[model samples]
Target: MNAPFPPAADVGVPVEQPMLVEDADAVAWDQSTDLLVVGLGGAGLAAALEGIERGLSVIAVDRYACGGSTAANGGVFYAGGGTTIQREAGEDDSPEAMLDYLRIEAGKVVSDETLRRFVEQSPETVDWILRHGGKLAASVWKEKCSYPPLDRFLYHPDNSLVASYRARAKPAARGHRAFGRDGKKAWGLGKFITEPMTQSALRLGLVFHRYSEARQLVVDRDGRVVGARILSTPEGSPEARRFAKYIARANMLLAALPPSIPLASITIALGNHYLRKASEIEAKARFSRLIRAREGVVLSAGGFIMNPAMVRRYAPAYATGMPNGTLGDQGSGILLGMSAGGATALMDKVSAWRFINPPKAWAQAIAVDRAGERFVDETVYGATMGEHIVDYRGGVAWLIYDKSLREAAFRQARDPKLVPFQRDVTLLNLLFNARKAPTLDALARRIGVDAEGLVRTVATYNAAARGEAQDPFGKEAVDMHPIERGPFYAMDISIDSRFLPLPVITFGGLRVAEESGQVLDRAGKPIAGLYAAGRTAVGLASQTYVSGLSFADCFFSGRRAARHAARANV
Candidate 1:
C-alpha cells in the first residue's frame, strides 16, 4: 500500500503539513518497540533510560549525533528544596520556600498544584541524577555572576537573589553544574550530564539511531499515535558512516579550542564545512523506515530556536538574536506532535539572554533605552533584561556606566575566577563598542539618545544613590552607584549588535497534560499514546527562563512520560 504522507525531504524549512499518516496497519513497519523516542537530547535520553529501567524496550533517534542542544549547554541543573548538595553547602531551604519563589518566577504558566509537585520532588530529582553517575560539587559559589567559572559548580542562576524574590522566599544557590571533564572548555558541560545517563541507557538495551530524523507521525483510526516514519542514512552504507565519523572528529577538535583562542573562527568554519559534507552524504543515503511504537511515542526533540522560519512565524522580534540550539532543534518534534492533533502554547515566548554580569560592576550601571529612559533593574537575570529590551524597548538599549564602574569591570575581567568565554566577550564589548564622552550630554548625543532625558535620568539615579530618594526600579542600595564621574560611557547592548550577540532560545511548544506528559489537543484532551518532554513541551521554563530550569524539566517530564507510557497496553 502507498504511504499516506509525502516523502521526507531535507528542505531546511519548518514542516508545515502536520505530516500525519493515518491507517498505521496498512504501512509496513521496518521495526517495532515498546516505545519510540524521537530526538535523543537530554529529555529523550532520560525517557529512554527510564523506559528501559521499567522493563520496556525502547528505540531512540536524533537528527545529529546522540547529544542535542543539551550537550552544547552549560550543564546547570536547577534543583533546590533541601537538595543534598544545597544542604552540604550549608544552605537552608525547603520545598515550600522553593515553591514560593517559583510561584513568582513561573507565574501562572503552570497550575499551583503542578508547580508544587515539581518543588516537592526537587530533592529526589537531584538524587536521581546523582544515581545515574552525574556529579555535582557541594561547594556554593556566593557571588553575582551570569554563569560560574569552570572550577565552580554551584551558583544562583535566577532572580532568587534579587531583593524582591529574597523578600518572598529565602534565597539559595540552586544551579547544580555538572562536573565537566574538560576544564578549559567553558561550554559543553551538558555532556557531563547526558553522557553518563546515555551510557547507562545504551548498556540497558536502548537502541539509538544517529543522523535519523522523524518526519511524520503514524496514527490509528482512533486518533492514537502508534509509531513514526523516520528518514535515516543507510546504516550499512560505508560512505555515510565515514562522513558521520568525520563529523564527530571535527566536533571533538572544535571542543578542544578555548573560547579566547584567536584561531577559533577559522576552526569553527572548518567544523561547519565537515558538518555540511556529512549532511550531504546523509541526505543522499537517506531511506525511510517505519518504527512501530507499541505503547507510546515521546517527542523529546527540543525547541525551534534554530529554525528561522518558525522564529519568524512565532517570534519575529527575536529573529535578529543569535539562535541558541543545535541543528536538531528545528521544531520537528513540535510539528510531529501537532500532526497528531497536539496543541501548542506560548509560541511567542523566547528567551533572549543579554547577560551583563560576571564582572558584576557592569550590571550596577544604568540601562537606558533609545529615549534615555531607564526601564528595568539592571541587576536582574539576563533573560529579564533581554525581555525588557526586546519586548518593551524596541529591541534597542544601552548600558550607561561611569569611569569607576568601567575600571572595576576591567579589573574583574583580569580576575582568574572569571570564565574565559565571559572574560573575552566582556572585554571585547567594553573596549571596542563602548562610546565615550566627557559629559552625559555628549555621551547621549554620541549614542543617539535624548540628551536632556539622559541628564535628567542620571540626576535622579544619583539622588537615589546619595540616599535622598528611592530607586524607581527597586535596585538595592549596594548595586546603585552614582554616575557622577566624568567621561561617561554608553555600551550598545541592543539585540541586533553584531559584536555582542544576544543568544536566544524558544520557550514555547506543544501543551501537555500536567500530571502525565501526554500531549493535549486544542480542546484540552490528551492525544492518546503521544507525549512530549524537554523544550518540546510547555513545561517549567515556557513562561520565563532561568539557566538550569529547562534541563531540570527535561529530567522531570522525560521520566514522567516514560513511567506513564510503560504502563500502556502493548
Candidate 2:
C-alpha cells in the first residue's frame, strides 16, 4: 500500500531518503524513507527528528504511541551538574571535570571517550530540545541525587557550563530530587506533562503511530536487520507482512538486539511483590548504600504508574493489552535492536530507581526492609528502585526504622497511588484501606497467604533484628537492629507485579556505538546502520544521569544516528 503523501522530493522539493529499502517480505511495508525507526520512545523520537532535520525520508513507529518514555516520565531532564559541583567545592566546573566524574563513576565500565562524548553533546541536546519545544526547569541541587548529584571529586578544565542548565531550562524548573521536601532545584512530571515537548516534536512535522508495536526485526541469514514487524499492542492484531517487507527493502540492513541485561536487572532486582511493611525498610537500607557511594537518587514509581494512565487516555489499546513479566512495553526496542544485531551487555547492574525510595503517591505502601525486618525510611525510590524490584528468594528486603522514622515518613507514606486506585491500585489497599495490620499473621490471613509461613518469616526477621539469630536471607546490608520494640517495628509489603511493574518504563537498553549511534554486539562490533539511545542503549551507569541526561542522550544519539545513516547514503 502507498502512503497518502508522495515522496518529499516530489513536491518541488529536493529532500533525500537516506536508507530507503525495497523488500516485499515485511508486514506493513514502506520502502521510500531513507531512515526507518522502530521504536518511538525517547530514542525513536530523537532519531526521527534528526532524520527530518537532515531531510531524509523518515518513517518511525512504536508498538505504542510516540511519547514512549517522555509521556511516561516525570519530565525530568538532566545534565552532569559539573558546574554546580565545582562551585560548591570552590573549584571550576569544566567539561573535563564532568568527564572525570563520569570516569570515576563508570569505574572502567565505559570508555573515557564515550564519557567525553556524552558530556560534550549534552549542551547541544538540551539546546535542541529547548529550541524545538521541550520545556525545562532547573535548580542548583547539592545533595546526592541521581548518580551522586554532581560529585566534585573529579575536575574538568572548563567551568562555564557547569550550572548553565539551571539558567538554560525554562520556568517552573525543579531540582532533580524535588520529590522530597528538601529538594533544591528541578522540575516534576506534573509540570512536564503540561509542557510542549511532544507538541514541539509534532510541530516539527514528527508523526506518531500509537498502539503500534514492533514485534521482531526482519533479518537475513547474514544477521543484518532489515526492518521490524509491528503489532498495534500486545493483544492487538499484528501488522501485515507487507509492511515489514517494505521497511526491510527500503533501509540498509542494520543490527538488532535486546536490552542489556543490566537494564533488565533494574526490574528484576525489585522483588515482584512489594510488601508494605518490610519493603520500605529494604528500600531505605539500599538507598543509604547508594548514598554512601555518592550516587544519585530519583523517584520513578509515580512515573511508572502514571504513564500508563496517560497512555490509556492518549492511546487506549496500547495502554492495556501488552504481555506481562518483562519490564516496559515487552521491550520491543530491545527485541528490535537484538534482531538487528545490536549488542546487549551490562546485565549485572540495574538502574537506581527501585532503591532510591518510593514516590509520594506510593510512598505509604513502600516499606523498607532492614535485614529481614521491615522499617520505614525515605518516601521515594530514585534510580536504585530498579535493582530493588527484582525477584529474590522469599521475596525479602529490609526497612530500617528509628525514633525519627515514623515521624518523618508516616504521614507521607499514606499518600494515594498515582494511578486510579481501583483499576491499577492493589487489591490489598482496596480491601484493607491501605492500613498496616498489627502482625504478619493478621496481614497474611488478610492477603490469603500461608499464615504459618508468614508468622515464621516475621519471627525470624524479628530474631535477626534482635541479634537472637541469623536472618535466613543472610541480609547483611540491613541497618536497623531488633524489631522487638513497638515504635521501631518494620512492616513488609509484598510488591505486587501486576500494578507496580505494569509501567516500569524502558531504560538502559542495547549498547550502541557512540559516534554513529549504531547498535553494537556483545563483542562491540557495530550492527551496521542500526543505532539506539535512551533506555534502549546500555551503560546508563557509565555516567551520572544528572538533570537532563536522559533527554539529552535521546536527542544526541538520535541526531548522530540520522546523520551517520544519511552520510552512509553518500
What TM-score, over all chains together, does every model reach?
A: 0.93, 0.52
Question: Which 10 consecutive residues of model 2 have the lowest summed lDDT?
Answer: 289-298
- For model 2, what is the error of residue 209's alpha carbon versus the real structure, in angstroms, after optimal superposition? 4.5
Q: Over 4 Å off in model 2, which ranges? A: 1-31, 81-93, 104-108, 139-328, 347-381, 385-395, 402-404, 408-486, 493-508, 521-524, 541-551
User: In candidate 1, what are the lDDT values of residues 1-570, reduced to their tens digit?
Assistant: 111222234324434453355666676889999999998998998899899989899999987777787888888999999999999888888888888888988858889988988888899988888888887887678777898877778899998888766888888889999886576766788988889888878988999887788877887778888888888876657965786787786675544443334575777677777777887786688888889998899999999887777788778888888777777787888878776768888878899899998778788889999889999988899998998999889999999999999998999899898888889888988888789999999999898999999999999999988889999988888988899887899988899775677889999989999998999987889989899999999999888889899998898889889999877743
Give all candidates' CA lDDT scores.
0.84, 0.40
Error of 2 at 509 (Å): 3.9
RMSD to truth, every model = 3.8, 16.3
The TM-score obtained by model 1 is: 0.93
**Global lDDT for candidate 1?**
0.84
Q: How many backbone clashes does candidate 1 have?
A: 0
- TM-score winner: 1
Candidate 1 lowest-lDDT run of ten: 1-10
